[model samples]
Target: MSESQNVIEIKDLDVRYGWGRHSVQVLHGVSLNVAAGCTVGVVGESGSGKSTLAKTLVGTLKPTRGTVMIDGVNVSSVRGADRLKLRRKVLQMIPQDPFSSLNPRHTIGQALAEALDPRHADVKKHRSVIAEWLERVKMPAEAMSRYPHEFSGGQRQRVAIARGLIPEPTVVIADEITSALDVSVQAEILSLIAGLRQELNLTMVFISHNLAVVRQVSDEVAVMYQGKVVEHSPTAELFNNPQHPYTQSLLRAVPGTPGFSIDPGITEHISHENRAIA
Candidate 1:
């Protein structure tokens, strides 16, 4: 996509945790571009830096080097009030664990209302708006009065989704939002996200470890290993012809693939391919 059509752009991003000698690099010279109205799946295993990337994009964590440009503003350069405003208006994140993310003390209505933009903070004035969003996420209007613990896992996630969209952000970063749910519930959540994306004209960055889930929802996919993006391409193309060894290994590791094996030679054979790609 053209630069003018891009909503998210990152270049040479590097992230390190801790100070001095104790520091460990988690992301290495990562780069990506997300076009407006497109869903890009960022796929990786545990500790592969997918969640770190999501945090960095949402301004919760700053990168050690490189730039994160969202809707023309450099995230790393913004400070204080500017950063707060950017997060509130431009981007929002739906975390993996809804039970932990939601405030147990707050009613569902209160939580959703708090997430609305300041201008819409008056719960009384925006009752219709809150109801609209709840309906959009397939929740009942009466759910507003209930507390988080009163609902099931899937219901809480639906509430979480409603909260994330309350502000009408341009970009939504969903970091493993469905991983905690059962397979049937996972399908329901994914279907909801797909429909919401179309109805709201949303741009999304979906972070997940499951290739099957990624393939189901993404228009494009970026495969990460260790701390680097090993492959990025249109979803179908990458699934059919992965150019990187790590990606191929991941595909082979998927359950039920014929002749799948934990062969040690696969890694040895792919080392040269890894070097070639690097």
Candidate 2:
């Protein structure tokens, strides 16, 4: 992928946790490209390195080897102010665990304001943007003063989305963001993301174990297995005719017809993966 064209690009990416004797390889030379203003979903079972990839892209977990280019800069090499500059404008991560991701000490609005005014600008300067995002995420502006525990799972996820987008980032990495909510709520969040993508012109990487959810929101889908991208194709093409064994397994596990019941088997598989990650 051309450096100028991609919002985020990973080439021969390898990530390992621990060191020396305890080291375990998590991502094994995985490579992928995310185009500007597109939604690319990464699907895999637990221990498959989905979160590792997301964190690596956002400069949270640096890859032990290979290259991560965010908006044409090699993020793995940049540090301090330079690294912060790259991440602040180019890429952001919406963590899968909203409760942990959100600050319990601060009000929702305060957190949003921090993301909007990272340099400690006057809150008055960014109040309009904060209110706009609150409305966009379907939360009342008054909810800004509320704490994280006061909100339901779906609402917390909305707050997380609002925080990630408040900065108007060019790339968003949503790591299994819909897993915490009920199906109905999941659909609402999906629609919200779709709307935001159009409105913000965002390039998104949505990581999920649910093929159904990925199908609903992603333009292209990449099936990951054992720390590698097994297959990638346009969403419709991949759902209709998956090429990889894991991809076929994932599709077969989806329940009911198109727009029907999400398969229980798929949920079980995802649950299993979560345990592995934990």
Report, for every candidate in turn, its global Cα lDDT versus the true structure: 0.85, 0.81
Clashes of each: 0, 2
Q: Residues 1-278, candidate 1, lDDT per residue (tens digit)?
A: 79999999999999999999999999999999999999999998888899899989988788999999999999888989888888877888998999999999888888888888565556677789889999999899989888999999999999999999888888999998877787667767777787788888899999988777787779999998888998999999998999999889888894634322233332333343335435
TM-score of each prediction: 0.90, 0.88
Clashing pairs in 1: none
Candidate that would win on lDDT: 1
Please state the error at residue 9 of candidate 1 in Å. Answer: 0.5
- CA error at residue 259 for candidate 2, angstroms: 20
Best by TM-score: 1
> Which segments of candidate 1 are over 4 A away from where they belong?
118-120, 256-278
Q: Which ranges of candidate 2 are over 4 A from the true structure?
A: 1-3, 254-278
